[model samples]
Structure formats: C-alpha cells, structure tokens
Target: MIFSSLLFIFRFLPIALAIYYLAPAKLKNLALFLVSIFFYSWGEVRYFPIMLACIVGNYFIAIFLGKNQDKPTVRRWLLVLTLVFNLGMLFFFKYTDFFIININALFGTSIGLLRLTLPLGISFYTFQTMSYTLDVYRGEVEPERNIIDLGAYVVMFPQLIAGPIVLYKDVAAQLKVHKNRYTLSEIDAGIGLFVLGLAKKVLLANSIGALWDDIKVLGYANISTPLAWLGAIAFTLQIYFDFSGYSTMAIGLGKMLGFNFPLNFNLPYISRSITDFWRRWHMTLSGWFREYLYIPLGGNRRGMKRQVLNLFIVWCLTGFWHGANWNFLLWGFYYFVLLTVEKLWLHKPLAKGKIWPHIYALFFIVVGWAIFAVDTGMGDLAMFFSKLFIPQSGISAGYFVRNYGLSLLLGIVCSTPYPGRFYHKLCRQKKEVLRIAFLAVLLLVSIAYLVDSTYNPFIYFRF
Candidate 1:
C-alpha cells in the first residue's frame, strides 16, 4: 500500500506504531518485521513468499561471507555468487519481458514473453541485500548474526518500496547496539516532517501533474511549442515532488522509529549543471554506483579513456535500472553525454556564470524529462521534441496558463529552498503554537485531497 493511501495512514501505520511502542525492548525488531510483512503483503500477497525467500537466502549468504572473510579468493567468489543471485532475481522479474520482445524482433524467433510481473521493491531490496553481502566480504561491516535483525532491516516498510536505498552498514549499529530507540521529541519532529511531505505530494505533485496529463490526453503532436514546454516542466515538477516527497516521508518515518536513513534529495533543481544535478538528485543511488560500481570498475583512477568508458557503462546500467524501456536507456546516455561534455570542456564555463548556468541546467533538465515521459514509440518522443522547438498554431498554451498558472508558480517557488528557509525562520522565533497549527492545517488539507481524489501514485513505484 502507498504511504498516501487512507487505509495505510489510518489503519496500518497506527496499528503498527502502537504495537511497536508497546512491545518489549527485545521484541521491537520482531514487531517491526511482522508489521512490515503485512504491509508488503497488502499490495501483493502472492509475491510475499518471494520477498521472504530473498530475506532468508541473503541471510545465509551473508553468514557464509563472514565465515570465509579471511580468505580473499573465497570471499571474492562468494561475493560474486551472492550478487549473481540477487541481481539474477532482479533481472528475471524486471527485464525478462523486454529481453524476450527484443529477441523475437531481432532474430525472428517467436520467443513468447514471460510477461512476468515485477515484485514490489525487488530492485531496492536486492540492492540492499547485495550491498550487505559485499560489505561483509570486504570486512567493511560485521555480518549480522541474527536473522531477525537482518530481516527487519530488509523488510522495513517505510522505505522498502521507494528508498533512499538504505545500506545495511548504515543501520546495522542502530539495529544491534542502540537501546533507547524512541524519544517524544523525535516523534514530534517526525510528525511535522511527514505532514509537510503529505502536503507536497497531495497538494503540490498531484495538482501540478494534472496539467501534464491534460497535455498527454491532447496528444503531443497537437500541442503548441509553449504547451509542450509547459507539459515537460509540469512533469519535471511532478516527479521531483512525488519521489522526493516519498523519500521525506520515509526519512520522517525512520525518525519516528528512531532510525535515520540518508537524505535522498537536495534542491537538485537549483543545480547549475548535469554533474551538479547528479550529486544532488537521488543521492543514495548515485553514491551506491560510485562506490560499488564506478569505483570497482576503475573510476577516474585508470586515466581519462577508461574513466569515460566506465561512465558509459554505469549510465547505461543506471538507465536500464529505471525501467525496461529504450527511452530510459536514451535518458541515461543523454546524461552521460552531458556529463562527459561538462567533464571535458563545459565545466568551467557552466560554473562561471550565474544566470546562464541556471538557464543551461533548466533547459537540459526539462528536455531530459520529456525523454523520460513518452512510452509508446520514438515517433511520439520525436513529436514532443518537435513541438518543443516549433511553434505550432494552437491556443492551448493560454488555456493551460489560465488553468494552472498558480500551481506552476508555486511549483517553481517551492523547487528552491525558500519555503524551507521560511519554515526554519519561523522556528527560530519560538513559534511552537504557530508551527503546530500550520502542520495541522497541512495534514487536514492533505487528508481532504486524498479523500476527494484518486490520482495519488508515487512516481518511483515503477522502479
């Protein structure tokens, strides 16, 4: 169930929190694990076994890694095997159909598509488990001996589906060492964080997303230049707030449980270049690739040529990680190209200017999202790109502006750090009553919106 859903907010979370707080000290992990399973199963009961099997499988794999840690060759072989198992599961569930369709078209072999449904959070949990095993092999962190704690870490519902991709080492200490888990102040802060995130999703992302939907319904070929740009910018805003909002909620929920997940997003829109953008956006994923994939693949240490090839590989894999689609691959390579350009030449120029840097960043960012949005065919993407440049004779631009002008303005404003700064400014004045009242209103408004509408999908769920 999505965090924005009424049932999850009113029923599952409340019950889970209550049981967790009421449980004995040692039983807290058990409590969380049980509730997390129930929460995950609420979405798809059939895949529940797959998730459990993963937990069990990885738990043992980690033990074996720990046992053979002193032998470098044995540890390397074990790490390879564990990654293969984890990544193999991820590929089979997520990419089997895409591969099947390509094979059928390429060689005229009628390979029937398995059309397998991807298990919820398969990519996330697999990465988490793989990281754990690798860390154990590398002696970066102690292996978790208790399967219960390991399961709890993997199945933690808050960030399970869409994550900042929490690493085992990050939370291992909290799980095994920390005794006093919760504080009233931390819970209060969590509530405030969650309320703000709810407002971002229900009030901002969902509302702004409607404009993009309207453009899609009208079809890209029919849209004017301004309308095409408007749709692209609207989606760019929608996805940021949607995914970042979910991450904020996840982090807030982590705080409520006295755990801290790494922050997933900074003000990425404010970035001046694509290189700066990756540094700020979905930070955990980039860090994961940097440490586990890029660094291991020779990184920049192997000279410029190898570094460039390494980046190409990482970007291709990163794109395919998002979905089983060619556009995603294009989107990945698109950034690879931009980042390569920046590294070789444009970095200094883009870093020097203020207004122009922002303009440059925003132009490419919007264009990238346009590539990300279209799904059916390259023709549709080409049509959208054409509309973005050529001014077709249409009056939809004025109509969209009239309809979503305020939302667009709010989106642009909130994309910066101004609202957060304003909130912090208020906090400095000792305005406890004002802060609580504001959060209460936000919660009420979000609840009202949730009750009234059903267009509340978090964009990262597909990944």
Candidate 2:
C-alpha cells in the first residue's frame, strides 16, 4: 500500500481520513490506533501480531522504567532488557540470514537459512519504542499510560513504513492535543506538499531511475566509464528523490493529521562535506545515533581516540542498519573514513575551498551510492567500481543522456534549494491563485503518472 498507488491514494486514505475526522475528540486516539493497525495489516497482516506484541511489550516496559526511576540499578536493568527485546526482534527478522550465511561460510557448515520475512517498519518502530523506553528511564518523558495512544504512535501509517523516524517525545504532545490541532490552512499546506512530493517520486525519481535500471541490465562489464558514471549519478538522484519524496509525503500526511513530523532531508546534495551531508540526509536517523549511541559512548567529551572509536561503532551499526549486505558495511566504512578524515583534518580545507569542495563531496557521494545500490556481492561491486574508475569503452552514455537528460536536469535542479525558494517567493508575493493552480496541476499530473506507470518503487521500504 504505497502512497503513490491509486488504491491507497483513492481508497484507503479518503476513507481513513473520513473516519478519523468523524470520530469524537475523546475517541480520536482509538480511531487513529485502529486505522493505523488496519493500514499496517493491509500489506502485512501476518506481522500484525509481532507489531502488537512490540507495542504491548514496549508500553509495559516503559511503564516499568518510569515506575522504577528512583532505583538506578533496577532502571538500568530494565533499559537493558528493553534494548535486548527491541534489538532481538530486529536481529532475528532482518539479519538472521546474513549471520547464518556468514557463519556457514566461516565454519564450512551448511546451516540452512531461516529466511524469515521481515516485518514492515520493524526497524523504524523498534527505534521509536526504544527511544520511548530510554527517555522514560532517563526521566525525560512520562510513560504513556494510554496503550491505544502509544499504539497509534508506534503504528502511525504515514511514517511507519519508512520514516523520518519520529521519536515519542516529538509527538507526545501532538497526540494529546490532536483535537485542537486541526486547521484548514495546515490541511491545504499538507496537500500542496504531498502533491510536490508525489511529483518528485512519480515523475523525477522513477524516470531518472530507468537510466540506472538500463545500465544494470547492460551489466557492469559492458558499460563504458562514462556510462558507469552516468548510472552512478542517476542512482544518486533516484535514491535521493525516492527516499526524500517518501519522507516529504510522510511529513505532509503528518501535517494533514495535525502532527508536525521533523524534516528528514535538507538539500543534502549541495553539501560540501561528508559531515554536512550526514547532517542533512536522513537527519532523524543521524540524530538518533548521535543522541542514543554516540553521546552514550562518551562522544567528543573524552578525547579524539575515544570519539573515533565511538564513530566507528555508530557507522558500523548504521551501515548494518540499512541492510545485511557487505556493500552496506563498506558503504558505512566508506563514510566512516571520509567523516573521520574530515573531522580530524579535511573539515578546514573543505570549508576553505570553493567549487572543488562541492565537486569532491558530490564525487564521493555518487560513488557511495553505487556501493549502497549494488547488492549482488563483492565481485559485481568491484567490477562496477572498475567500470567507474577505469576507462573502458562499450556502450556510451550518449543514448541514455539523450533519453533521460530532461529528468536528470530536473532532478539536479530540484535537489537544490532554488526551486523551493522560488515557490516560497511566489507565496510571499500573495500569488495564492497561481500557487493553488500549480499544486492542482502537480496533483493531477502525478495521479496521471501513477495511473499510467508501473515503475513506482519506494526505495527505503527495504530498510
């Protein structure tokens, strides 16, 4: 039930919104909770029990932590137990096969893969639940007594599948006051933003993604250096638009529902440094690690060496968090090296440079995406890198560029802040009619694209 699908857009959303709006103020949380469970169950009904267990388990665990705040030893043990429970579920479903394969390879044992179906949004909800428990233990937030409210927060369909990764504290107040938070202006803004995001996903990302898809089918060995680089750039754009589009849609939906989800992407492509890129890209995830993992591991407070170790741990886990692939590990290590170098030395020089820094950051970022995208194992990954770095002639990028040049241009331009700035300028000039017309056209065009195309894919759903 992707947001871009006609079924979801036309059926589920309208009906759900109608039900939600018609519900009494006191029953709003219950309405939201039930509707959200239905949404999750629509795609993965088999996993509803797992999600229910998580909601129930974490809710009680948090309550226990909140109650045992005065006892440090008991609270610490409960927090550890909570971590084990959340991480255990994630590990079993997401990484069990990876570990099995690795162990089989290392020990020459034919361990059959469990091949468990990962519950959708398990990664995201796990973090959200953990954050709630951790905050409760820290005395930062009172435990949510209302299980229905907590369940609604956990299974909120908008950001549930692939998130900006909303934390409990961020929406705790909004959940309480949702009755009063509804406004026509906010709904209008949400519609506009959702349409814009829909255009980005259906039009720009999917069209540009076709180029990379073609290159992949052509095989790494058959592609010219230019073609390889072009594919890398295309993938870079596709992933950004795909994930950012989903996040934008999720945020917009949050707005419509009277919740203010945090910003996820912030023109990350324009970042001149790896550090800057991380700050902009999947910002909530970065913040999650920074707050829960990095700071706890002493952060920069101890010394450079300790901080480096902390970063290594965070990046390794961050990489693994994306998937069980070795390429993801390399991708994380790749950024770890880049960020460590920048933190230790390159930051000053990057800031000092002008155009070259942007080029340098972009160059590495594109290469990093290649690593992230190629999951066919190390041989293909190495071959792809060879095609990218070593000049070889086979198929030129000319044909692909001719086919996708407009989409590429649009993607590049939209990746920056200029388009958003221009739109805002029009709004500031009181061009309400123009704004409304533009949004209407965008929505109609996006719906047309959705109706016509079968290539709609949400990249982050795998995570």
Candidate 3:
C-alpha cells in the first residue's frame, strides 16, 4: 500500500511500529522482516511471495559467492548469474508486455502479450538486492550470515517502497548494529524531518499535481504554444515535488527508526550544467549506475570514445528504467546530446557568463521533461518546444492562475528547501509560541486537504 493511503498511514504503519518496538533487540531484525512482508502483502498478496523468494535467493547466492571468493572464475560466474537472475525477474515482470507489443509491431506478428502486472518497487528492490549480492561477491561487504539481517536489509519498509536506492554497504552497519530504542535527539530530528516531509507531500506536491494533471488533460487535444510551455513547466515541477517528496518522507522515516538515509536531491534545478544536474538529481541512482554499470563497462578511466559509449548505454538504460516508453529514451538522450555539446563545443566560453549557465541548464532540462512527460508522440514535444520560444496564444498565464495560482506558488516554494530551513530556524527560538502556532496551522490545513483528497496516491510506490 502507498504511504499516503489511509490504510498505510492509519493502520499498517502504526501496527508495524508498535510491534517493531516491542520486540527484543536481538529479535528486532525478525520483527522488521515480518513487518516488511506484511507491508508488501498489503498491496498485492500474491506478488509478495515473489519478492520474498527473490530476497532469499539473493542471500544464498551472495553467501555462496562470499564463501568461494578465492576462486576467481567461480566468483565472476556467480556475480554474473546473480545479476542475470535479478534483472531477468525484473524485466519479465516489468517490461515483458511492452517488449512483446514492440515485437508484434515490428514484425507484423499477432502474438499475444503476456499482460504482466507490474509490482510495486520491483525495479527498485531488485536493483538494491542485486547491489547487495554483487557487492558481497566483490568483497565490498561480507555476506550477511543471518538470513534475517539480510531480509531486513532488503525489505526495510521505509526506503523499500520508494527509494533513495540505499546501497547494501551504506545500510549494512545499521542492520547489524542498530539499537532497538531511539534517543531523544534522534526522536527530535526524526519528528522535525517527518513533519517537514509531510508538509512537502500534503501541501506542496498535491498542489502541483493538480495543475499538472489539468494541463496534460487539456493540452493533449488543443495544443496552444504558451499553454504547451506552461504544461511542460508544470510537469517538471510536479515530478520534482512528487518524487522528491516521497524520498524526503522515506529519509524522515528512516531517521525516526534511528537509521540515516543519505540525501537524494540537492537543489538540482540550481545546477549549472547537465553533468551538475546528474550529480544533484537522484544522486543515489546515478552513483549506483556509475559504480556498478559504467565502471564495469569501462568508465571515463578507459578512454574518451569508450566513455561516450558508456555514457550512452547508461542514459539509454536509465531512460528505459523509467518506463517501457520511447519518450523516456528520448528524454535520456536529450540530456546526453546537450552534455556532449557542452563538453565538445560550448565548454570554453559559454559557461563563463553569469545568468547563461543557470539559463542554459534550466532551458535544456525544461525541454527534457517535455520528453519525459508527454508520452504519446514527438509532435506534442515539438509543440512544447515551439511554445517555449514562440507565443501562439495567451492561454497560459491566465489559465494557470485561474485554475491553480496559489498551488503553483506553493509548489515553487516547496520544491526548494528554503521554507523548511526558515521554519526550523524560527522554531529554534526560546519562545514555544511560534512552533505551537506553526504546527497548529499546518495540522488544520493538512487535515482539511487530506479529508478532501481523492488523488492521494504516492507516485513513487509504482516505481
């Protein structure tokens, strides 16, 4: 179940937390594993077994490889097999239907597609679990001996659903050595982070989500130039808040449990270049791709041309990883093209300017999300590109304000960390009046919105 859903927020989380704390320190891992299975089963009871099987399979594989690390051929083969099996499971479940449809379209065959159901966070957990096995085989981490600890590592409920893609090594120590009880300092930090994240989702992300949905629905049929640009910008903002909001909540939840999840976002929009953008946006995933895939395939350390090829492969896979859609490929390569241009031709002089760097980064990424969002065809993307430059109609500014002006403003504010930082600073003052007043207002508003919300799905759970 999605974290935003009533069942999860009210029922599952509360029960799970209660059980988790009641368990003995030695049995905490067992408690967590059981709760995680319950959490996964809450959505799709059938597929939760599959997830469990995969988890168990990987643990054994890693244990086998770790035991036989001295034999080079055996280690290599084991790692390869682990990755193949992991990705095979992910691909068959997540992309087989799309792949089958493509085969039929290409070869004029009428073979029926598998029509497989996508499991929540299949790609995410698969990658995370695979990382654990591969890293253990590589001697980056010792294979987890207790299957229960491994289970907790793979199925930690906070980052399990919508991830910052916590690496095995990053969270391994916590799994083995984590305390059962949280300190007062941990509790304070956790509460602050949780409240801030809740505000981001309930207040900011939802506002932008409505505007984004409205724009896409309208812009699909009658595409005006200005309106198309507005839609593109709206979507960019919507996805940023939606995905980042989930990550924030996950990180906050981790903190509450006395675990620290590394930051995922770092004001990516403020990046000066495409390379800088990758460094900031979804930092964990990029780091994973860099360490696991790119480096294995010969990173920039090898040579220039191979580096380019490596970059291309990563981007294409990154795109395909987003969905089975062609537009995502276009979205990925869109940045690759700009990155190439920046490196080859524009490196020396263009980046020297003040506004131009920010402008350059913003301009390219704005168009990039056009590919990411409008999934049907290139014509819509082209229309958006045209609208960004030329004004065909004045439908944008008026329509945006009329429909969701305040939300748009709130979204813009919440996408940045400024409001949260300011609030924290305000709360540190001696008088408890400000903190009291702020939470009271926030609680009333959040409750009001939650009561009215029908589109309360946490988007990243489907990742």
lDDT of each: 0.89, 0.91, 0.78
Tell me the TM-score of model 3. Answer: 0.94
> What TM value does model 1 have?
0.98
| Model 1 per-residue lDDT tens digits across residues 243-284 | 889998999899899898999999999999999999999999
Model 1 lDDT on a 0 to 1 scale: 0.89
**Candidate 1 or 3, higher lDDT?**
1
lDDT of 2 by residue, 88-197 (tens): 99999999999999999999999999989888888899999989988888888999999999998999989999998999999999899956767998888888788888
- Minimum summed lDDT over a 10-residue window in model 1 is located at 387-396
Question: What is the full ranking by TM-score, best candidate first?
Answer: 2, 1, 3
Q: List candidate 1 segments past 4 Å from native.
A: none
What TM-score does each of the candidates earn?
0.98, 0.99, 0.94
Query: 410 in model 3: Cα distance from truth in Å?
Result: 2.5
List the candidate 2 regions with Cα displacement exceeding 4 Å. Answer: none
Q: Total clashing residue pairs per candidate? A: 0, 0, 0
